[model samples]
Target: MVRITDEQIEQWRRDGYVLIPNFLSKEETEAARNGVFEWFSPSWDDYVAAGRKIDKPGVLAFPWDNSGLNKAVLHDDLIDVAERILGTKDIHLRLVRLDEAHLGIKYAGNPSNNSLPDVFHQDWGNNTIGPHHPEDFCSPAFFYCLDDVKPGMAPVQMVKNGLEPNPKNAEKFICPGGSLCIYSTWTWHASSEFEAKEGHRPTMWLGFNRNDRMWEGGRFFTIKATGTRDGWLRAIGEATPRQRELLFLPAVDDEKWTDEMIDGMFKRYGKHGFDPEPYRQAKAKREAQTNGKH
Candidate 1:
């Protein structure tokens, strides 16, 4: 299991994203690599980029789903990391896409790659959910690199504190093999264009969104993508500190939060729109179910 420290947690709260190296072991990484191809596919490259589909999917794409791609969707390590980061019991696995562009495919976002619209926009446009855009309330995502990415051969460019403003100019994340990038919904990031400096770039994008209808993290896979890693990432979530307080999680109840509890926290800290009475009762019931209540 991976260990997290106060520094890492603080970094996430402050920076909107954290870099974790070797998130998966060589064995696990290999297992994921083999898992995708274990099924069926014609080429080492994705069926899409091989001129299979036009009007291509930019950086986001995938294959398989809850009803399709079998167990790779339940990768063990991915689940553990999600649990620590999301702090909720329910995690809805989103799309799994491997991005590795070749010379042939059609670019979709902005025809003129030089003036592409792939600038900066939070997945939740204006932080609202409706008919226009679907993805809402998606908290975090796991970007795993299956191979060694040497700069130009397709690296991910992320802003430093994107929840606010990214002073860094397209920071290229050069994480070696067996590492994963953990990013919250607030961070603004982009997948760099794939250029084979030495070896072919192979990366997997596994996203998890909250299971709320208001959140469309589970958006549909609708276009042609680049190379396919043929691997999978999994996710599991544990109740967060906020969730525990809202649900009165007995499992974590013993922790000293009394200081906040005495300060009119019921009105101050809970969801802004809900009533405190129902929340407390619901919290009590949920706490009784979880053990170690606060």
Candidate 2:
């Protein structure tokens, strides 16, 4: 059973993420690859037509497979860890996709690689839905590598302590397999265009939250999350009623807000001390501009 050490757990809370080594077994890693093949191989026939994402070479900028896919969430292998981090047994996944980052003489995609690679920016651009009130996060993202990674292959880089109590020290860390990376909806990150640097082709995922108090991510215990041979638990499972509300993470009404709204917010927050002043200021300014146009 893989119990998340207090150190790893606390690192995630304080640093916005953490790194754990030798997290998955070879057999388990192979399973994740099989899942991708089953879903993406030309044989699946109409999997995408049914509204399922089909795996393909360039679908992701990295190489990946999903043989070790967790049945609980149907796509997120680390949802149990996510649940533990959120401190909620009941959880809902924002979205899930199996991916692969292939290696070669050079990176995949256009070799011309003329333009810059993925831009270094936070999620959802400026339209982040929350971080201000009890509402949905604009766009938090997560990634799980399906293979053992080398920093030169498909490495994902993030700013250390990128988004918490005020992110500082923009240092970058390489997340390897048996490991997953999560980021706030508003963190700044990036990658190079076939630079031949030390990194791995990593599968990436974008996920939202199903908790009123939402944090990006944490670690998981594979053996304990499910019976070693128990196939019943998949990636992400169903959410409870309370979880459903948190999943909705409703957008606060900017136009309808008042000093009374602020009062209600403080009372509701009580001692939790979760503050969204930054998000609120941003949202209000956007709303004001929109109203002015009308």
Candidate 3:
């Protein structure tokens, strides 16, 4: 029973983004942070030590390999906001990225020797899938902070209301460890420099898209770059039915929906005080419509 306020919805509609502070408990944030450190830090450190380009493109795929990290991505509050904002229960996880900014890593061949590549741009491009219009809210990126992100800690600078080239109005996402900063994929944003002398800025990037979309740019890149299809399938296999629904795989046909499935749904969602009857009824209607069309 998580809810999004009308004011929050209006803010997103107006600014193309919203920051929900304290969206996760401190315990939840700590668990996710530990999981990332355990699972991703080694490779990330190796990449840095190799003197490879710091601004290497592509994300760390399938961090859900860690069960704790998987749970964070499927956190109820995050899902509720996503579903409400996207205006759909049928959502798909386009990407799960673990991004870290260390104290002294900088882009290669840059004279400034800045510790971050502060490039302001949108996630979508000419080669991206679907319409390029800014009005299309098909994809959204949720950034879950794993550390208290203060200014100069490489907080992401976003142009409020999609306004770019206006430094006076740019909004820096400085918040506590458990905050969730959500923005449309089309919104203009960039990372600030890691001005802190020590420590790391770790954040989990969860990108999602409406299920009806035929193509997802991140999904395409993930499968290609990370060879993660098998791992992803395994992760999904381990998820609960509700979690599987978030993955946006083809739904189980209503004809195949058994008493056991319905009971399981109740057993799971009921604990959260959710009544599943309405969802079940609506699903049945959708099935009826599909069967009729067939």
Candidate 4:
């Protein structure tokens, strides 16, 4: 059901990126859109008074409090696509960011209405400290448009097989809300200019790579953030065990899941109704298998 076709996989191989139009249904798209606005615009009156300017675009790295975004971040389809391309089920989360681009603002230095953070560049150039070949399985990234992205609304600009920024070869990604753009960190891309007179562009970027190469990618938030940010704790409590594994938590049957460790997990996350039964069951199953072998 929620699987990508072989054609899509080939596209990624040939072009280093693929755009899945309407990856999310209207309801799901609206939910994510609502979350963006609710989190960004708490007070509409003041937001409107400020000329709909949100001061600056807001970014929530690994945000767990927003139910809509959390669902999309851990959506089954997202993982399905990642696993298919990475050729491994052992992938982990690299970046879970909710990014916003407000309109009607002038860029500081570049006077060119370009709303993106920087000029065209390969993500791997900054994502890694060393070199990487295009053939290597680098971090795969996603840009989920939370709202309709029309031309001149700062849609994503990418160059096919481009090693550097070449405006002549660059192509603009103009798609409706709920659309998803999947590309590798090795792909060359940048943000287009935001020239819309009235409107905003809200998008989310999710990135992941192989579990063994944890040092290769970056994320804004870390596990320790849970202590200070309630959203992190909430995410821990609410996430499914499979989803937790993506966060690099131990598997249900991991050797680390001793009674003490399980108890610690409960102590840390029981407040948000975290279920420990699965861990307990895994332990019992392992014990049963051991006794049977003996």
- For every candidate in turn, the CA RMSD to the true structure comes to 13.3, 16.7, 7.6, 4.1
lDDT for each residue of candidate 4 in 212-274, tens digit (9 for 90 to 100): 776666543465542126656777788888788887789888878899988998999998767
lDDT of 3 by residue, 1-294 (tens): 564576986787788788888777888888876666655542235445756434332325553345556677777777777777779978866653222111122222232343233567676762255667878776677777777777666677778764653445568888998788778778777777666654456677666666777465454333345424543544554555566566553355444455566667556545534345645775788778989998
- Give the per-residue lDDT of model 2 (tens digit) for 1-294: 445566776675565556555455556556654544443331123333434333443222121222244321233335555565566644545532221121121233322222244445554433233344312332335655655555444345555543432123343445444455656545555554444422224343535444443342221223243222222221112222222222333334434345465456545542334244533665678778989999
Number of the top-ranking candidate, with TM-score as the measure: 4
Error of 4 at 21 (Å): 1.0
Ranked by TM-score, top first: 4, 3, 1, 2
Candidate order, lDDT descending: 4, 3, 1, 2
Candidate 2 stretches with Cα past 4 Å from truth are 37-67, 70-77, 96-118, 124-128, 131-141, 162-176, 197-202, 206-208, 211-294
Ten-residue segment with the worst summed lDDT in candidate 4? 99-108
Instruction: Tell me model 2's lDDT, rounded to 2 decimals.
Output: 0.41
Model 3's number of clashes is 0
How well does each candidate superpose onto the true structure, as a TM-score?
A: 0.52, 0.48, 0.69, 0.84
- For model 1, what is the error of residue 245's alpha carbon versus the real structure, in angstroms, after optimal superposition? 22
lDDT for model 4: 0.69
Candidate 3 runs further than 4 Å off: 42-59, 96-117, 220-234, 250-253, 256-294
Flag clash pairs in model 3.
none
- Model 1 poorest 10 in a row by lDDT: 97-106
